[model samples]
Target chain A: MNIPKITFIKMNKKEYILIAGLLILGLLSYFFMYNIEPGAMVKIEVSQKLYGTYALNKDQEILVKDSKGVILCTSEIKDGSIRVKSSTCTDKICIKEGEISSSGQTIICLPNQVVITVINEKEQIDGVLK
Target chain B: MNVKKLTLIIISSIIFLSLIYFYMNRNIVVAQTQFIMNTTIEIKLFGKNIDKQKLVKTMNRAFDIMKEVEDKSTSYVEYEGNAASLNKHRGEYYMVNQDLIEQLSTSIPFYKLTSGEFNIGLYRTVNIWKNATDKNYLPSREEALNSIGNSTPDDIIVDKFNNRVKLPEDMEIDLGGVSKGYALDKVIVFLKNSNIDIALINAGGNIITLGTPVDRDYFNIAIQDPQSINKILGTVKLNNGQAIATSGSYSRYYEINGEKYSHILSGNSGYPKHLYKSVTVITNKGIISDILSTSLFLLSIENGRKLIEKLDYPVEFLYILNDDTIIKSEGFKIEYSQDNLYKDE
Candidate 1:
């Protein structure tokens, strides 16, 4: 009976250097690609339209309305957080959602079809369901 | 090794590193957002296996359907097919859109389910509060009290055969509490019809999930702390076809001289209920969750629990008290973070 012998190939300097470079590249990609910044502004949308985008640093009130000119709600930006101050809609659920400061935080008014979202320097999160 | 073999090894190594770079650069989650139903609605889906174009198209369609629901059910808008017109023609029979009929019909049952605690016919009472809050003052006690019992849920007559409805002369219809949930339900139906199961529909504080996300056993949701809006006291994990609706006094309140008056008025008292900081109801039905959340906030915990026990659908409750105490139903599984000082009841 004859047995087949298995042998290990020795890696030279070039192969070792190439493998080390690949490992470093992978680590670099992981850090650079995954880093995300916090949200800086709150974007308000009413009925599928861009109502306005307000800086989180500024304190102001944004009166959001539907296309038909009905004032749906008032959004107040204060202390880097935005919240629904008042709404003509009966449920007033959006007002109850309080303020959203984080990048992925959101406040939605279903009755008014109003959506308010927090956005970072870049749109980092996949989606925000609030 | 020969030069060709060594060159091949380097080439393969380069290819492998580039593949890793590309994989890392690829988006892990795909999300789309639209302004719908007077709120910002975001539909987020996980996994790269989903068809991006189809999901986008489906999301847009869901918004359109939700808009239709909103338009039909909105009491603020006076379009030909809207609920405002129906309220405007309260004395006589007014032909309404099917969506309006369905929403109103769906909500009427909740009135009885909550022992008249969840009344949509309190439009007059709501208007009084709105008018008062608009002027930066609380409504006169007499005016608020007078608005109470002005109309009952029975005042709105639904004529199914004629496809019309009649409201009492003094009565008005406001679907504010139920319409959002109804819209969510309609959107869920639309998503299911499109063969998209793993989706979450969040209409403001009302959240509904169609199916669990691809990577997780359950969807984790943060319950906003009433005292601190940005921080969450705890999280609730929901399975497929589940929903959570939160009603709180802290959300829509009138602050006069530093006193916070919640907008969640009791149907019986005709004034805002200040017992709890917030009430969250987790259930399968959107409208039910919405109604129960509001009703539970309006009622005492004992009454609220009795109401929940009578309902056929299973539900869990969580209430954040004014003192930051957290009370939860036996079945509600909430994991509070170490930083939270709220005690569980």
Candidate 2:
């Protein structure tokens, strides 16, 4: 069997610190970033397809469709988080889904064909659903 | 070194190693995964611009798959798609998808339990309503009466002897509730196999999420308040491999005499019902998610709950009653937001 090269190059202090800091950031982000509460809205779009006008709820629901007959989606603003609620399609995939409180979260509806992204509508979210 | 110093040094090294690991995995968050269509269509994956032309194309492909099933399964379409193939063998035939066949069969029982509130047939009746709205032509009273109630599910045969569907000529099957959900399932599998760890698929209005949010464990979903168009009652939290589907009367309906009739037709009346305002079902199965949402809407809240209880499908429910009382299943604990726009009841 052939052995590949195994070399250890010392990383500079800044490089080591930067890497360590990044790992801590990731771990903290993983455990603490999304302390989810139910019915948090992640994405909101106004789609005309569901009803006359529909509103997206925190359970990824949409209660209203616009008067224009398009499903209107808007993120539910709450003290906790955001989500996509109502949509204009027969299948209610959005409503059954709960909430994501993370900075970057998203909900997509393929039927009315909309995407709800969680961002700090007040401040930029830490990540994107993408 | 003393014991305290030794422990501190070891912990520091551990932290340093973890840092290097995270740095090495940096680009994974933004990496673009493969896009697939039902293993039958191809959709591109781009995190940016979900409405972009490419993403739309993928969505369109998912629609195509839905349409294909509709074309094949719906008696309304006239062209014999798979639905016809399955239906033609109704009584004596057991379908390869015993799961689908069984779902329909059990759903029939639900309709019976709901006093035909949740039906599997009535394709002919469905046509009457569809034509009434689409072509501005309601079926003749005689036509409406004759087309429906001709064949009960008991009369229909599931021929296990041969994989065929059979029904009285007057009666046809429509997978309206399950078709889109089925399509969602297949699409998710396609996405998963393509090594796409994270994705969201919406079939018409049904949404299914695979994997976690890019930066969160739970995905936030909104629930529409029944009375208001621009309001949200609450939100649902979703984790990896979870799906949410809602069925409400607010979306598709025709109004008559100051009364509203939704598209969720009543199997018995051959018209829509004033059941609960809406019912939302959360489960992992997209097909079940779709059917149950529609089915529960058509069923009485008690019967729907009974149906859910009998099944072990990891199901939970939320019901908005006719009186607008919000009822959550014992299992349901969706956090109510501070800005909850609608009355919980």
Candidate 3:
């Protein structure tokens, strides 16, 4: 039978300092990367252009306008949800769609070519099927 | 003995490890939303090694493919050689693009498969309802019944070799039910050929998944409640290469004299049926999922089951009745939202 001898290497003060510095760097990076939470925001786009973004926490009404400065639709935010109050389009589907609070939900007025979506940094659902 | 050299090696290793960590955690998701086919078409691509500019180009091409399909299949607009033209020249053989030819050939069989319940020749009937809705009047039952002339698959002739199609003299074709799904299939093929493995395309309510996401086994899809806009009924786990489509009467409707009529019309009655409030189908092919969702919505639970049984491949379905009774296939798993609005049957 043959016996194998195991040796252990001891680290000095400089090596301990390097290890501690690396750990601190990793922790700082992790916190900086993920700790900041931007609340849910509503993104309104007109004809594929970013019209504006508003915080869901605030209760306000957003009037969407086209290139000619014509009002297309008015969306209202209340109780952390948003809904289309009125629109210039023939079909009131956008108004009938009611309120949407969760992320990834969209209110699209095809005639006006406006799309309003609620966006959150950490979206729970990948997509919503209507 | 050389402390500075040891320190240099340790610091370099830390930097190297950090690079590896960041790279390993980098999962890029590129998504673009465009309005095409009268709905929002969102294309999402996922990967670890994605070139953002190249991915955007691919997405644009995918949207172009959908636009081409729409231009060819739309009954509202007339292109030089498309469905609108074919509808105009009914009873005469008219040459068309090969894509339209393929769509017709693929969809004509479903008309017989669903026993005429799934029909593409409802253009006239659809127009009647559209006009009625615009004028805020209810079309007479007799008018709807008369508009559905001879619209059987046997009446439509497709000369595949010549890329020509001829509709019956009285029949007008509307590819609304299958065009979006066909476009989805086309885009998926284009993406796969472009070496895109993970992607999700949502055209209106029709969704198709490519490979699985980087972090999850399947995509989490939430089915919206037909009764409520803010609430979702449940979530379905869609696996790779699977497509899910929902046909709900609540989405688009015609309201006349305080009554709501669904957009999905039945071939027999030439009017929307209230058998189910919504029907959802999950299948392997996007076109099949689209066709079945509409067909099953018009069918009874038993008849739909029989139709599914006759098919060679597997299919799962979910039905939400008027009374909020939820019926689903055995293999279809749904995580119901914690709401008492719907009851599982």
Query: Which numbered prediction scores highest in DockQ against the true structure?
Result: 3
Q: Give the per-residue lDDT of model 2 (tens digit) for B15-133.
A: 86777555433322222222222222223242321334544555555556555554554544344325655556554443434434544554555555556666778776777776666
Give candidate 2 regions above 4 Å deviation: A1-130, B1-64, B78-80, B84-115, B134-146, B159-162, B256-259, B337-341
> CAPRI verdict on model 2?
incorrect
**How many residue pairs clash in each candidate at the backbone level?**
14, 105, 0
Error of 1 at B228 (Å): 0.9
Each model's lDDT: 0.78, 0.59, 0.86
Model 3 regions more than 4 Å off: A1-123, B1-25
Q: Candidate 1 regions off by >4 Å?
A: A1-130, B1-28, B34-38
Location of the lowest summed lDDT over 10 successive residues in candidate 2 chain B: B30-39
Candidate 3 structure quality by residue, lDDT tens digits, A1-97: 8878878678889999998899779766754443112238899999999999988989999999998899999999988889999999999899999
Model number with the top lDDT: 3
Clash count in backbone of candidate 1: 14
Q: Give the best candidate by TM-score.
A: 3
Q: Write the per-residue lDDT of candidate 2 for residues A66-122, one digit (tens) a residue.
A: 556554454454446554555456677765665545535656666755655554442
Query: lDDT per residue, candidate 3, B64-182, as tens digits?
Result: 99999999999889998889999999989999998899889988987777788888888999999989998989988899889898558668999999988888999888998998999
